[model samples]
Target chain A: MVVKTVEGSFAVAEAIRECEPDVVACYPITPSTHIAEDLNRMYADGEVKKYIAVEAEFSAISALIGASAAGGRAVSTTSSQGLLLMHEALFAASGMRLPMVLVVANRAVSAPLNIWGDQQDSISQRDSGWIQLYCETNQETVDSIPIAFKVSEETRLPAMVCMDGFYLTHSVEQIDVPEKKLVEKFLPKFNPEIKLDSENPLSLGVYAMPSDYQSFREDLELDLQKAKQSITRVQSEWNNLTGRNYGMIEQYMMKDAENVFVAMGSVCGNAKEAIDQLRANGEKAGLLRVRAFRPFPFGEVAGALNGKKNVAVFEKAVSLGGAPPLFGEVLCALNDLSRKPTVSSFIGGLGGKDVTVNNVAKIIVKIKDGEKRFEWV
Target chain B: MFEVRFHGRGGQGAVTAAELLAVAVAVEGKSSQSFPVFGVERRGAPVASFCRINDKQIRIHQQVYAPDFVVVLDEGLLDAVDVANGLKENGVIIVNSKCDASALNGKLKIKEGMKVFVIDATGIALKNLGKPIVNTAMLGAFAKASGLVGLESVKKAVNERFEGKMAEKNVKAVEECYNELKQ
Candidate 1:
């Protein structure tokens, strides 16, 4: 592990380069632009085998689908409207079971046309059949890329490693970039078991009538849930190699705590500090950081918040007229609890609003004071 | 942990300055984080960046609201933005201007006991780098005024950030600024 002080985006690019992808198809978007830029430079310098500068994000993902179908370890990075532009293709990539990786610098979608950090972009694609892993720090983001690729290949599903835009992606810090040999040992070359071959011609993503469509959907769902095991095993393997352990949900100060703040992405960092401050004031506050959002980690989340007095679910995206995305999921996870925690929903930090430690501590205090079921922090 | 906020025009290297400081902090075997205020930035718009240095891992990911030090890259920003807002008492403000302490005191609304250090970073940059980019020069003043980083570490960070003549010139600017600051 070589520790270097660099921008998070460049660190991610370096990690992706070490993965030695056969093809990288990308269209530049703010916050995520530096990754594409660095990879394109690597491509020009002959470090990467192929780099396709697509006109738009739709074509970028479409090109990745083709690349992955042709048996190449493919990857792409995008954010905000760019991810939205590839909405249809996202399902297509996953529906076809094309194992690939996408790094999303999570940003707010716009009718107001803002370019800032938020989880609304990736959260809106929750049903796209891709594994979603949110990161709280640059080192975790760097580590998640290789883990995403390994899990994607193992589960035959695509993975989106979501790092907060302008928060993690744009931040500069010191991180350990893993050695190429270690990654090589951890991840074997992408030799797909099946691919588009003219000699042994086969079809993929063919029309699935109602008779078979439901079963195919069920298979993908089951495989996504089972992929959690693969994620854990791979992450544990990575831990053994690097001494950095990660889990689907990181429980911070949860033991003997009555109240917990649940969140994803960089907001978890602020929440952790808030937990520390609350503990100082003799308040028993904990933080549950949801690293893997796709597999949903229902068992672990339910286990952690099983007997807590209050669970404040803070998220960057809302489900509009419905329950917020994460809040709704947490509610379901804790549904079978004999004594369910009073899980409150909070929607804040949208459009890159600074969700400071103070805001997080106050929410915990409000939860203690029996605040409403939902709030806009 | 010590937090520093930087105020500059969008075209200036405020963000890069913060990053350089973070890298220098790393050279001292400490952890640091730096980031710019995200926005649809233009060349001349007022912009801000932040840096935090600590002995352990810096886990907080929010902007530095109450900074221990404020570094202003352009004196023009003093009239345009609240460069000193949320600064803690006894904090230090380093400005890249020719103005002395009393002149800058009239312009800034700082709390009592908060020292204000003035350096002609532009002049230093012109003499050493032959450019108006005062980011590296300001960092040198920051190193001296804040006593958070060493001059050699800042020079090494500059060398890491730039190559060849650019690195040499920036290091010279850093040294000149460090020598110019009385603190």
Candidate 2:
């Protein structure tokens, strides 16, 4: 590993290059544009091959689906409206059980035509059958790329590595860029069970009658739920190689705490600082960051918040006239607990609004004061 | 930890200035982080970027609300922005202006123990780079005024960021500002 001072986008691009996918198709968009640009430069320099500059985000993923079905490891990067445009293709890619990787520099969906960072883009695709992983730091984002591919290929499911746009993508910091040898040791070549070669042409994503379709859906559900173990096992193998501990949910200062704040993405860093300040003042505060958003990590989340009386789920994506996406999931995770935590929901940092450490402290204070209603901080 | 905010127009290289500063600090074996204020970036519009330098790793991912130094790339921003708004007491302000310290100090509410450094960066850029890009020149003044980083590290960072002739010219601009600001 080489330590380099670079933008989060550069670090991610370097990792993707190290992974050495067979085909890369991308359409550039803000925050994610740098990754595509760097990879394109590498392609021009004869470093990586077969980079197809597609016409739109829809074509980008469609191209990946084609490449993966052709028995090749494929990758792409996009955000916001670009990801939204791929909504139809997203389901097709997963339903066909084609293993590929998508790096989503997560951004808010546009209605007012805003182009800033938020989780709305990927969060809205919760039912799309892609494994979603949210990262809090650039180092974690870089580390998770190879892990995503390993898990995706293992589970026969496509994975989305979601990093907060601009917050992590545009930010410049020091990160350890893993070498090619290390990546190769962790992730071997792609050897799919089936492909579309003329030597053995096979049908894929074929039409299913309503009678047979429900069984296919049930199979997908079972595989997704079982992917939690694949994620954990792959993370462990990566941890052994890199000496970094990662889990579905990371707990901070939660051993003895009554109030816990659960969040994901870049906001978790600020929440950790808030927890430190609150602890300095003699308050028992803690934080739990959800790293894997899909396959939901239900068991780990419940174990972390089992005895806590108050839980605040701070998320950037709202379901619109319903509980926020993460908030609803947190409720489901705690459903079997004998004494459930009074879980309050907060929706903020939409469109890259500054969710400062001060805001985090105020949210915890409100939870302490018995404010259980959903709030917009 | 030392936090610095850079205020400049969209085309003024404010964001690049912050990133280069972080790279320079990293060269000295220190941890630094930098980022621009996310929004619709347009030319000639008021913009700001932030940088933080510390001995340990930085965990906070929020904007810098209280900055130890503020650098203004355009003097016109003084009228449009309260550039020194959350600046810490005894802070520093560096600007790429033809006006002297007292002239610029008259516009800002300079606090006790606070210092301001003024350099004709636009003139220096024209003399060296043959253009009005003053970000690298302002970085030189920032180095001397704050005494937080060495001139050699700043020049090295500039050399790494630009190539051949452009790198040589930027290094010259930095040296001119550093020498001119010497007390």
Candidate 3:
């Protein structure tokens, strides 16, 4: 266990490299370019063997689909606009049941052409049938790699490790970069459910009749549902190996709390600080950080917030006409509960704007003052 | 958690300085993070970077509003920007200048209990590295002023980044500024 201060992107790249993948196909994007560059450097230094630098993100993910179908452990990385361009390929990868991992240096999608940290990019892909996990630090980014591969391979679902773009990718932080030998023990080689070989002549995701398409879609949804268990199981295995366990949600100061702030990604760190300050001042404030979004941990979220007097969800993206996507999900999670807290939503930190500790604490104060609100901070 | 922020022109190595400090802190067995902020950055434009050093994992991913220490790589930024805008109650500002600490403190008129440390880091860098890249030299002064990262670890981090004569010059620059600092 060699601990060192490294940038989040490089840490992620090293983690993926330690997995000893068969292929890494990716293109460079700001805040995310270092990930590909580092992986490419590993190849140049003879630390890796297979790498494919594609024309664009669309091709990057598409190449991964081909690589994964051919029985290779494949990986890729992208940010806001690149993720948007690869939208179609994203669904195809999952629908084809090609298990792979894609690291998302989460950034705000552009009209003004901004490149900074935000959750909108991955949040927009929540319905694409991919497993999503948000990371709070570079340490978590490194820790999630093996778990992502394990869960994806088990459920045949493409898993995404979403992290705040510049916030995590560009920031230098201390990470326990795992050894390749240990990671290999944690992650066995590719166990493809079906492999495509030239001599064997196989077909994948092709010639779907109406009935076949319906069942394929149903199985895809069912597999996504089943992936939740695999995610938990994989994390349990990782905890047994590394003694580090990050469950579906991380709750801070939630006991005996009257108000709670829920958030994801690196912003959860800010929410935790705010909750600590509120607790220090004798306020009953807490924080619930959702680590997983797809197969959106509804039960755990509802269980955590059932008896709270108020809950505030601070997200970085908007769902246009409706409430923020996370806020909407939180409401759904709480709807079936007998006890429900009035939840408010705030969209903040867009385009890399600062989401200060003071901002989160202020929202907690508002939630407790009998004010239910949803607005940009 | 102790927070620090750096202010300098785009061409200066303020961001690199912060990252190197984080690496040094990590070598000390503590958790640290560093990031830079810029918008349409140009040469000589004001750029800010932030670092947080903690005994445990730090969770807040926000800009340092009330930094325990603020490093000004260029003294010129003192007039152009509100360098002490959200400083902590007992924060210190380390400046790279040849002026006396008392004179710089009086000129800034910062908050009460806020200490100011001035060092001729630019002069040391010019003498050793033959140019005005004061980031390494100023880092040594930062070690003197903040006492968060050790001078030895700072030198090691610098050595890892540079090699041979370049590394030796930067290390000498750090030692000169660090030794000259009359804390």
> Candidates' interface RMSDs, in order?
0.7, 0.8, 1.3
**Per-residue lDDT value at B106 in model 1:** 70
DockQ of 1: 0.88
| Model 1 / residue A375 / CA error / Å | 0.6
Alpha carbon RMSD to native, model 1:
1.1
B27-68 in candidate 2: lDDT tens per residue? 999999999998778999999999999999999898888899
* Ranking of models by DockQ: 1, 2, 3
Q: State in Å the error of residue B10, model 3.
A: 2.3
lDDT of 3 by residue, A1-377 (tens): 78878888888999998898888988898778889999999998988879898999999999999999999999999999999999999989999999999999999888888888888999999888899999987888889998999899888899999988888888888788888888888887887758999989989989788868889889999889778889898898888888889898889899899999999988888888887888889999988989998888899999999889999999999898987999999999999998889899889999999988888889899888767898899
Report the C-alpha lDDT of model 1 over B53-150, residue by residue, as the tens digit. 99989888987888999999999988878877989988999999997878987789978889899999999999988899999999999999988999
Between the candidate structures 1 and 3, which one is better when assessed by TM-score? Answer: 1
Best by DockQ: 1
Clashing pairs in model 2, backbone N/Cα/C closer than 3 A: none
CA deviation > 4 Å runs, candidate 1? none
**Clashing pairs in model 1, backbone N/Cα/C closer than 3 A:** none
Task: Between candidates 2 and 3, name the one with more favorable DockQ.
Answer: 2
Q: What proportion of the real contacts between chains A and B does each prediction keep?
A: 0.90, 0.88, 0.86
